[model samples]
Target: MTFVKNVPTQPQILAWLNHVKLFEGLTQDALMPIIENANYMDLKQGDMISYEGMPLSSCFLVLSGQVEVYRNTYLGEEKIFGIFSCYDLVAIAAVFMPHNRFPMTIRAKIDCSVLFLEKNSLLLVCKNNPIIMQRLLISFSAKLYELINNIDWLTSSSAEQRLGAYFLSLSSKQGSQFILPISRGQLATKLGMRYETLSRLISSWRKQKIIAIEGNKVMILNVTYLDELTLPSQRAF
Candidate 1:
């Protein structure tokens, strides 16, 4: 995979995350309620943090490095849901879901540092920090919006439109040139198709001059076309 711009050290990255959107304008004492009960854990590469069946409590904030959320698809093949990086909140659904079990497994793509807060501790944090809590509600709502947007993207006019929508998501995160975080197989899983199908689609895309893939770096040659695909019809008569 094409590498992300090297982020700072773990502690520095942690500090950065602590100052992010949800935590912004919030003093350490304001977060002290949750931070006090939170434990900072280091993970070795390829280590699995939470498995599918086990119950989960505390949510993880990826303070440093990248992580993969994946599980076995209905087809019995490993499927990647997404890649999470610094400042990304993990295990959110389990914290609020009915069963309280992680729907997917979390694996470290590289050495990682995550802040874990216990259930009671998180509740206390919310109880104490109303301002930060408001911001969190906004953040959670934004996640729901993102999922809804994904649904819209899936209902593309054509196969190329679907592929274009996918690259747009990556570019939004990684800048103009998107570096895919997973292999061809895992990407196929994310796209809900076989590897060969995705390969053929990419081949056709290259032929159509929509995108150019050299290794993991996917250069968007025509954003106009991709954007047009993503933006639905305006109900013009």
Candidate 2:
């Protein structure tokens, strides 16, 4: 339940819902009811939207800025689950799972704008709008598939492979060089490493002539090697 302090106008909320790729399946006509049922909630920079272990009440759609999902373990270290940017949906799992409660604490990684949709209202939208319902089902299925792929990176991997995967994910944005959107600490959370350790590893990769790093720009010197490093022997993602 973290967010920025900006209150969004109706046009802004519509723009956000339209921008999100998952909602692309809905026509302008089809998206109206969901919009009608949705509520616009604003939060300050350090505000929490949903706490760990809370009942899943509303799903959030990011209108601007970023959010971090993290969990604290026995040692009190906060392990980030992920950092989501504009047009991304948060509380995705909770939206579809009746058995689900929020599993982690969500905080604004930076100042952000977000919209909240209550569960029953969301359900009514789906039930009444067949087009949205169909899209939601398909989108949920695709989400599950993507989650399995994400688990692959976490459960098993070599150092080289993880770094390669990181660069590849960045490369998907545009061009041979792109700025990483997330911070070093958030990247460490996704990569399952300490922040300082991840920084050293990136430096080591540069020294090894694997890639050229300038600020957030990482130029892959050898895509072949990077692909080899990130993908496992028996699996290709």
Candidate 3:
């Protein structure tokens, strides 16, 4: 990990802050305190950004690349919780938590850059700016709902169904053909399945011409069949 010695200029900071959902409609004046307190850093792949129970000194704004949020199970295996990409703020909710500590470990999935926004600065700004506080609440609520949905999906859905739903969700954003952003191993962990199970399912899909995989790229050859895999009744046969 490399800490940037020079802080970003106000204009540069404002440009990036404007893209963040939590600061979407805030004016330049309203964002000054945050911009002043933020610093930049670069992380190489596998660099640990924060560990579970780490003090919430600051939160991160992803400027580029991706970060993985994961926790170690009692059995000592890593379970990926989520991936955050550009413009996503990581661990902002932890700032308001009673314990003010990270709940999971965060690491660079690939080489990445992030803006570190100081927690005290953020809280002070939010105290005087109710709009910012409101936006934070909204972002936290949305994330909570997404987490609940994921719990339901992971526990109730079959492995094939889970993979299909994941692929379909990616396809919606990137069309029928797009590179898998992370490695297959990472994908398997994110989907809550063993690596062998995921590989076998993908292999079966390949032979059936449901999807084609070339390296990390996936092309959906049979969109309808792939979609049907996500439906319990349709997969009975």
Candidate number achieving the greatest lDDT relative to the actual structure: 3
Q: What is the TM-score of each candidate against the true structure?
A: 0.81, 0.76, 0.89
> Given candidate 1, what's the lDDT at residue 155?
60
* Clashes, model 2: 8
| lDDT (CA) per prediction | 0.74, 0.73, 0.87
The local distance difference test score of model 1 is: 0.74
Model 3 misplaced regions, further than 4 Å: 232-237
Q: Which 10 successive residues of model 1 have the least lDDT summed?
A: 1-10
**Predicted candidate 2 versus true structure: per-residue lDDT over 46-134, tens digit per residue:** 68877888989888887778888888766666777778887788886677776768878998877787788677766766776677667
Minimal lDDT window, size 10, model 3: 228-237
Q: After superposition, how far is residue 115 of candidate 1 from its true place, in Å?
A: 1.8
In model 2, what is the error at residue 180, expressed in angstroms? Answer: 3.7
Clashing pairs in 3: none
